[model samples]
Target: MKKIAITGATGFVGTNLEKYLKRSYKVRTLSVRYVHDQIFNITDDIIIHLAGKAHDLKKVSNPQEYYESNFELTKQLFDAFIVSKADVFIFMSTVKAVADKIDGVLTEEDLPNPQTHYGIAKRQAEEYILGKEISKEKRVFIIRPCMIHGPGNKGNLNLLYNVVKKRIPYPLAAFQNERSFLGIDNFNFMILKILENKNIASGVYNFADDEVLSTNELVQIISETLNKKNLSLAIPKSIINGIAKFGDLVKFPLNSETIQKLTENYRVSNQNIKNAIGVDKLPNTAQQGLEQTIKSFSKK
Candidate 1:
């Protein structure tokens, strides 16, 4: 079996990926504390870099932490990969690296203009990798995945699930928005395909499920999953905005940032990656994947 060395092996994605890939590849983890020279010493045939500082939703993390973990650490690792015998390197970036507010379906061709420290830092790492002179023998993949969810996921989706479980009405149902999500199963499939296929050209590709879901539709799905009636209430947008402003003043839960996150349009195109991987569709539909995730939450 081919050997694979992964960074961030203890993370949500990394743990799942290591388990999934162990059937076909000999997987090992490189410590996050390792320097560039230490990374270069690994004898793995593939390197999957997943270590990075995630976006601080609470806005309490130090600004320098993102740069150090995402940009600087990736720079060191990529430099090590350049000289190492690793034939494949996969860097896990995010859809936030491109744009915060999507005007339309986000494609791989879109120029990056990341706003937050997290997004900006990931973008810088991506730029650094692209600017390098890679050899023909090596393949580098920079995968920018949208909001990822699965059995272990405990993100915004979980928050939504909690609201539905508690029988709370979804207040922002008035805003119709579509967003793309990447299921962990599909994400695992994509990486395995990339690792096994040597003919696929290395490039920046967006990863998302085949279907996009509106927030209201998502709430309905949650209700269905829980065998409960949907309690989504469509409040007027103007009223919601006013409430958000009040929330900002009072430091309440329904603040501007939370509202934007719940109603943002973040449709990402997975066409490029699908084409590259020689697939017409992903393994799971958007609804199927989300239902599975919601079910997992209920068990907890």
Candidate 2:
């Protein structure tokens, strides 16, 4: 079995990936806080770099933390990988590395214009990897995944699930937006394919589910998962915008950032990656994966 070492192994994605790959690969979790140079000595065939400062929705995190954890640490680990015998290196990046707002569907052809510290840091790490010369025997993959959701996911989706569970009406029904989401199962499958297939080239790839869903559709799915009636209010956009501004001033639950998140269209195209992997479609459809996630939330 190929030996795989993953950073941020205790994180949501890392934990799930480690468990999923353990049966086929010898998976080892590496500490991001440890000596960087020692990464070369881990004796792994593959390294999946998942450690980085996640985007802080509260905006309370120090800006420098993003660079230190995402860029600096990744640079260190990657440098070690270059000299080591590791044949494959997979870096977990984000769609935010390209653009905060999607104009049409996001693709690898688009130039990066990151607006946040977290996105900038990840882009820097990606640039560092791209700038380096790789051995003929080695391959590197930088994946930009959109909003990921699955069992144990905690974030806006969980919050929405709670609101629906409490029978609260979704007030953002007036907003019309479509979003791309990555399911853990599909993501795990992609990683496994990347690890097993040497024919695949090394490059940046966008990862997302086959289908996109609007917020209204998502709310309906959540209600259906709980076997409850869907209740959504189409509040006027202007009214909602005013409330969001007030929320910003008071640091309330529905701030400007949260509002943008709920209403923004962030469609990402996975065509390039899919073509490269020679797959017609991912294992799970967006609705199927989302229903599974919503069911998990109901159980909680």
- lDDT for residue 173 in candidate 2, whole number 0-100: 94
Off by over 4 Å in 2: 34-40
Q: Report the CA-based lDDT of candidate 2 relative to the real structure.
A: 0.90
lDDT for position 154 in model 1 = 66
Model number with the top lDDT? 1
lDDT of each: 0.91, 0.90
Error of 2 at 264 (Å): 0.6
TM-score of each: 0.97, 0.96
The residue pairs found clashing in candidate 1 are none
C-alpha positional error of residue 294 in candidate 1 after TM-score superposition, expressed in Å: 0.6
Q: Highest TM-score, which number?
A: 1
lDDT of 1 by residue, 50-163 (tens): 998888887999998898899988988888788888889999999989998899999999989999999999999999999999999999999999998999876879779889
Q: Which residue pairs clash within candidate 2? A: none
lDDT of 2 at 246: 98
